[model samples]
Target: MGENKNIILALVLSGIILFGYQYFIAGPRIEAQRQYEALQAEQAAIEGTENAGVIEQDDAPSLPLAVSVDPQTDQSSSGNYTYADAKTIAINNAELSGSISLGGARFDNLFLANHNVELNGEEKVQLLVPANEDNGYFVRFGWTAVDASISADDLPKATTIWTSSDTELTPQSPVLLRWTNAAGIEFLIKIELDEQFMFTVTQTVNNTSGNPIQVRPYGFIDRKQEPVTDGLFVLHEGPIGVFDDNLEEQTYEDLRDADGGKFESTTSVGGWMGITDKYWMTVLIPDQAKQLAVSNLSYKASGGYRASYLEKAASVPAGGSFETQTQLYAGAKIVETIDNYQDEFGIKLFDRSIDWGWLYFLTKPFFAGIHFLFGLTGNFGVAILLFTVVVKLVLFPLANKSYVSMSHMKDAQPKMKALQERYKDDRQKLQQEMMAFYKKEKINPLAGCLPILIQMPIFFALYKVLYVTIEMRHQPFFGWIQDLSVADPVTPLNLFGLIPFDPPAVIAIGIWPILMGVTMWLQQKLNPQTNMDPTQQKIMAFLPIIFTFIMARFSAGLVIYWTWNNLLSITQQWYIMRKESARRAAKAANKA
Candidate 1:
């Protein structure tokens, strides 16, 4: 039997390594490799986009990075649209392109690495363009008009911007380009990048008309990235963001999220800003280091006011344009830094954030707070144990009740055995009688299990805490259990290097599982089963060995939880049993 159990343990060990490699390593490797090929394709695509303009003008920048709508060439040309139709904006650099539209005001485009765009409408007159677009649809928006410079105190107004496609881009004219002077109405608006990929562009209506006007902004810029799963952590805070040193150091040379150590990973503190038909991006992270609201991995968008959801009222005064500042972050979203940020911008990206009701609200915050406190202590294992103790203490009343009931139930096991023998044939009747007996004696068969069941969330939450958190990566502990993430080294894998499994955290060959199984068997004997039959007894005894096999290759953290829980439980049971035995003996002696 010992040999058979060792054989099973070996098989389980092999399976874990194989599964880890296949699911976590191999698959991501393949995807990252594929992304490398795609980034190369993006660079090649630029050639086709500029071929028309370059072929016409021999003096054009021989190499192509930015794509533009050529007014120098005829607009009648035709070609398939590719990502190269968009200019490659190095995430950390500031880039600007000024274009004078046909009989239009000169639009100066400025890109900041901190996820924001500043349109300095000086000397140039602003035009208010009504945004005509669909519901929940986000886009870049601006207006068209002759020079109409207006003063700040005067009612700011401008002519509507004509659109070839949808006039619904803005329900009314956007209020970004507010007039600083009375020199006609200077039209202006700004787009704020919300958390993650969501964009919120706002144009306030500043007016003394005693009424509020609401408008939406719209425009378009094509975005592209070769997808890769493996890299330093990624945080996508959309408007407000952050990044660790490792992630910030990535470059866009290959323009892919991941490469075969061949491509550079990059971050765009400022994403992309579209001016009229032209687009600009921040090529580097220089001045965009400090920020205002919605802090994430990168810096903040310090240029604008952090708008409120409820307090702002989401309304603008008529005749007066609304003023707002916006920031954008376009780059690989490092998940580790995002989680570490702990703000709303980072929290919304987690998969576990969407859990329901009171448990969802309470659990995530509770676990995160515990992690924060324990992470300070420099040991996750110790933190987990501390967290467990706190939870147990909070639920002590229920535990006390369960323990008392179990004390009664364990003492009655002899009587229950006698009843089973008496009603061996009438099983249904036996169950009814046993239930009545329990009610009469106030002995609960399910009492002890209740505390454990109630405590299951802490166990499961700790599992997620250990599995998902990158902080625990390669973290070491006392010898044998070097890494808390994996099980303690007790069993050998290769067994003389013959089998696939080798010694990991486990040190002793195969003693731990047998010992664990023995404890389980003893616990079962100490706790009585009132309504159980011969078949039930078989199952109860068999569970110990079954669980032993299951836990042999499990994580040290999980084993720690169970082992401590069981040992503590055993001590409690033994104390209660001894006291009860003494009490009965004393009562009998007094009666005699």
Candidate 2:
């Protein structure tokens, strides 16, 4: 009894210590960091920093001309030039429709034709925007001078106006742009679009005026601002790419902390790199088996980030043409689309653009199984329900034994209490007697914890899949559950959308979370762990409400899966308990 009290005291102290550290230490540190970052952002904004919204890559063969298109901006580092109104060239494909700006030959204005901005809404999902606009995000393909003597004006700068041969760019029809430099170099850029979001850009230069010129082909995607992410802990929503056959992620904060706000990799091959949002990504993939310099750069001036890669320098002799091809992926990060592109284009680890995290091996298979079930059931919610049933069936034998042990322990509870009272003054003897009693009944005190230990990994893996996989995004379940990847939108405080007022997050319990809590409470009631102390019993009773509140902000699909699993557990435990009770009753009758 004394030893048990010590154990209970230790557990309670541990919980208190953990809570105290989080509330008193970690919480304040996080808030202070947030405030500092906000202050820095505000100060930078007041100072009108140059390229404040631009994200760039460093260590490229040649640096892109840093030209500011903002008229009010006075930064002279970016060449001095008058900006012109950009003429738009339309691009139409099966999956998307957008336009390219002629002013700088930038692929700007793209929208996912299939994905809606809102659930069951008609607005198309916009992915890319012009560099000068808000959140100035767009992909630009151009050349940089390998020769230091080559004038910046001789190259196609951000404000360069090029003439396009075609009015529209389509998957079947590519658009070509031509520009001439007084230094006898004629630059040709061919932009080709696939049915999806992949853009093949071929940059060619012809030395027409007889002098040999050297230049390196370069491409970059620029986002003037960071994306608004759902959450920061689980999924990566910033600079992510494949380099040298390995996956790499650099968050916005990581970039800002890097020396000079730059990171570069020169030893990369057969891989691609780019920026990724929650459900969309824009990556630059150079030709495989080719040597390329890649970099992720952050700039305070533009208040954004950019991923750029440069290919080997090409020398165009008099009457000679030099050309290079690179691919641009800008659209939804659909799992199938990304994987297919990975196999088709040989983009190494392209599928990793999704934030699979460390437990990818487990999370991926779970997602695949659930995806297969989704196909069969046609609804993710129903598929989740079926998946729970399958998992329970697989664990039936282990759970059966565990329940039996728990039942035996519950049956011995009265005897345990009597021993405790008799040995109230003898702590060591009470423990010895309790052990003997457990041995006589063949009950394992720790058996009740086994099921939870077994289920923890599966629970986390399923949560990861539901949170990170784009397949779960906008996936519908039954009524009122529109997007499984997002928290249930209808809150109980608003009477499940019947009322107009939005409640505080504390009271914003969703239907699925509430159901999960109720199921948990029911399972606890059916569980035969009656030896728990009064404190433990109260904690167990409150666990349902605590878990419901904790999971209210999680993905609805995950809550549904957990709730279904709890119900199945309750069913199994209740049945087992009834059978045990009946058997005990029959034994008593026989003795009588």
Candidate 3:
């Protein structure tokens, strides 16, 4: 009985220690860090240390010499959709540089694409376009064409270095573009116009100067501008390309976001603009360049989200030309669109952009892999099941060792109980004897708790994965659990014969928690506890019920994983117990 009191004391003390550490030490430290960051942001905004609205593309205005018959009309040969063959591709917003216009509005899209065109030899270059409330000026809502055109000969000689296209602005969907050579070279452009905007290349090459131009190219996104606000996070796509040096984000000085604000994901097919996806610009250039430049996405007038400019250099080998293409997305971060999109210009969601300790990095790959495997079956629940099996397999040895120890203690229970009765008055001596026995047998008293300790972090990590991962937001798990992120459904106060059903999450029709508790209870019953205090045994038995309450609110994916884990443990423990019992029986018979 006193031994049970000691057990209760330990549990209570642990609870108090946890509470104090949470409220007094760790809480204050995190709060202080947040407060400091907030202060710095406010101070920067107030002091005007940086220009809040300097769109990168417009830093240096383009010298677009205008020439036109009617500025108001669309310069198209096919009724309204096709544009005329003009050497100068007119951009609506003249300030388009490396920034984007979809900064903080309901619709936010920053487009950046890199393309490679084989010239005489393989040459690479980069193009950049950022769209933020502070920087992107490429999305001109209503405006006349700002002339952006240049000739093939205007470019310098090819340098043959790898590059990335910094600019490719489309209205909403990508404009279909093709390269044609009449005089020197011509580009047939097809743009899809929504009621919201217009797009054009700020400049085009006047081919009368030359011909057959072998162009080599790549793409880039110029995000060298300050963020719209200090508090906003910077989400970016991981560096993707064939070049080793260019794939590293650390090398770029101007584009770095210390806050780890850059988040990245890929596009789905068919150009569906849901609430959670973004877009990128596509670029194509000639073999090389004596000089090359790019800018952000932003609007030229009223400081909005659109911009257009021209970059011209490189002397083409008469009859040589280059062309690039991509779409501009000015929209929100929709989970459905991003998670399943294959069209891919790597879009990073908000949570991935946050700094959430080691968990952020560790769980990212795990989440992605699980999603990929289970995503194929269209059942995230099954995917989680497979995921659980893998985790248990990895930790199988640890569990096996623990089960073996438990079986041994079960066999020794008779001796342990005798000792307890013998040392009933001497609690300290009883504990010392038990410890000595355990030490001699090389068994750890804490073996039973080790699995829990190891599982807790993985469990927490899984929680984070389900909560923030857009992929699981609306995913279904069997019939009752429609959305894994929500809570379970149960009874409510009846208002009428209308008979209102409980919400899905509250519905006990879900069997995951019940199964989890049962497996846990069975595992506990199977494990051996020798000379255990009665109260300690009860607490151990009741633990599964407490766990059920906590786990019921978690995502179905998480509950499913735990359920599988527990069930496997039950089978393994039962098998180990049977084997150990048979061994003792054989030994007793032989001795007798």
Q: Compute each candidate's TM-score over C-alphas.
A: 0.46, 0.83, 0.46
- Which 10 successive residues of model 1 have the least lDDT summed? 55-64
Model 3, 239-312: lDDT tens digits are 21111111112212222432322212121111111111112222211112222222122222323221222223
Local accuracy of candidate 1 as per-residue lDDT tens digits, 238-324: 121122221222232221323322111133232222111111111112113322111112111211111011011123445566544
Candidate 2 Cα outliers beyond 4 Å, as residue runs: 1-84, 148-150, 300-302, 411-443, 495-500, 582-592
Candidate 2 lDDT, 327-410, residue by residue in tens: 899999888888899889888888789878788888878778888999998998888888889889998988888888877777
lDDT of 2: 0.76
TM-score of 2: 0.83
- The lDDT for every candidate, in the order shown, is 0.39, 0.76, 0.42
Candidate 1 TM-score over all chains jointly: 0.46
Candidate 1 vs 2: which has more lDDT: 2
Query: lDDT of candidate 3 vs native?
Result: 0.42
Please name the candidate that would achieve the greatest lDDT relative to the true structure. Answer: 2
